[model samples]
Target: MDTITVKRRVMMPIRAGDVMAEFISFQGDRSGKEHIGISFEGKTPSFASHVPLVRLHSECLTGDVFGSGRCDCGEQLDEAIDLINQEGGYILYLRQEGRGIGLYAKLEAYALQDKGFDTYQANDMLNLPEDGRDFRIAAQMLKALGVSKIRLLTNNPDKARQLIMYGIDITEQVPTKVHVNQYNHHYLKTKADRKCHTMTFDD
Candidate 1:
């Protein structure tokens, strides 16, 4: 396990629309990841699950903040945020740009994808892992926040598997809304086929 134990640093109240939340920050001993937790107020809870809705969202600068149509990162993030705001849960925002390949290498891989290769092949061309991401830090963050079991919101199975390996019980899985565009259709296909993600696209 290469993950460092994270300790709770600060928790402050923040409001988004009618939703009130507590923004939590964690300090890692060695890991250099900016991990955070957003715990919204339980105004209208999801009694169907009887647990908080949790999402482990990796930071995608181009797609998340900039709304790049190259992928569904930003759109899925919006969905998770809205879900949390409504039903009250947590969103663990992890600083893993390009699935931990970082921003520069991600753009480099994108260049390769434009040259007629799928996402996995693009990473292979760049001498990078297909998905260089680790979810143990998210597990650590959840543990520090006193959340051992949750209803996970994600599309990638790896996220849920890794968290389970770290002992977080996944009560349910909330799939992210699929946003397929011409720019990211092939990319998403590669993910579903090669990465074992739970998605079916008409491609």
Candidate 2:
């Protein structure tokens, strides 16, 4: 595996609601593409030669940043932050937009979903991979941060397997579940059924 070049690290205060967190940023590379790492201070010791609770979360600018209800991505991100804050771990924020298919294609897929297609089927219609995200960059970033193992927080089992395949030891799996609404119910189901995401819906 190629070593990621850490261009710089900086400390900044992050304010979300009433919670203020001290975060460190590490700019690095994964498979030649730039990636960023944001680590929040936790109650537990940092990097004690064991796997930290790591959330390898992908970027969802529309849902996470803008709070768009088109999907549950935003809710999931908030949940991850809360868990990591409590458990004292790291969140590897990946820039894989639209599951690595990019924003334009994701928007196209959204249109297909509106026309009566599931998320996977919408990608299929667009000749895009159901999920194009690659976690190799995440692995590199983790190693650079001195993380050897991780209790990964995600609903997608493939994420766990992929990270392990990239030489990061995965000690446990943390499931992320969010309530679904009229807009994202089917999209979540498609992820569970087709993409092998471990999500359960009460409704």
Candidate 3:
């Protein structure tokens, strides 16, 4: 695990209402990836509490920027912003695109998905790890933010496990809303069934 330190903090406003956001940068990240920590709090004075509700969101250009329905990244991001704004927390926007396989490989996996391969299977076909995200960075970010304990806002158990492994005291595991649609039904299913993400679909 890389030893990380707070490089800078910038105040910024986002689209998710009147929340107070402090974007953070880090130093000593071995990967040299620009991971950002967007901390939202104090907008609703009474909603702010002791323990922060933190979210570790990986980068997804296709889904987050273009609103692609092939996955729920964008929706989850939007939801995280709103919920974290209300509850008071941090959103660690990691630059781990396509589960750490890079954009092109992710696209290749997508091509394989079009041929009936599951997300993991497509990655396997590409000789790539199914999920190569390292949550140690997230833990380091939280530590830099002076947070040792958190109520994590995510459905992925792996996130919690990794955070715990990296010395983040997970006080609670908060599940995100399941965003399932025609374009991402199978994708979400693969996440739930194979990845063990906590997802319950509507009947």
Candidate 4:
């Protein structure tokens, strides 16, 4: 396997309503999408400690884009951006939509979910892994940015393993706080029950 390299990086202003941030785009070979997008709270060339607040957010077109209530992904993305805007950190927005199953497949899985199958079971019925996302690319992006130690903002423990495998040091695991509606409560529970996600909030 090839060690992912940063092909290009550019500093740009990012505005999410009243929340303003500066982000550096890390482009890889695949192009047209974010391999990694790091949004910081303050000015560039930060004087903060080596252990930065980092969030490895995989792409979720359904939730992150359309604000679908079927899952907590959109809420998580919004929360991550808001927190990073305050705390000063990097939100590595990776292009691993639907846990790497892509958009159309995820919609199909949603149909299966409506048929009473849970998220993982739906993926299983589709012959896909419950979670196909790989955080090694996130690790590589962190290394490229010269960030090794991080307070990883996530609930998934597998993210830690994948980063460790790629030599990234996780100083802390910060579980994401999300707004759970009736539509996503069971989805979140399925994550906690079947996928081993650490969920602290009551659903």
Best by lDDT: 3
- Regions of model 2 farther than 4 Å from truth: 16-33, 44-50
Question: Using Cα atoms with residue i matched to residue i, what is each candidate's TM-score against the true structure?
Answer: 0.90, 0.89, 0.95, 0.87
Off by over 4 Å in 3: 16-19, 44-48
Per-residue lDDT tens digits for candidate 4, residues 110-146, read 9999999998899999999888887777887787777
Q: Model 1 over residues 40-154: C-alpha lDDT tens digits? A: 7655755843688899988999998799999999999888878877787788888999989999999998898888988888888889998888888888888887789899998
| Residue-pair clashes per candidate | 0, 1, 0, 0
lDDT score for residue 138 of model 3: 92
Model 4 error, position 116 (Å): 0.5
- Per TM-score, what order, best first? 3, 1, 2, 4
Q: For candidate 3, which ten residues in a row score worst on lDDT? A: 41-50
Off by over 4 Å in 1: 1-19
Arranged by lDDT with the best first, the candidates are: 3, 1, 4, 2
C-alpha lDDT of candidate 1 relative to the true structure:
0.82
Of 3 and 4, the candidate ahead on TM-score is: 3
Candidate lDDT (C-alpha), each? 0.82, 0.77, 0.90, 0.78
Pairs of residues clashing in candidate 3: none
Candidate 1, after superposition: displacement of residue 130 in Å? 0.7
Query: Which of the two, 2 or 4, has more lDDT?
Result: 4
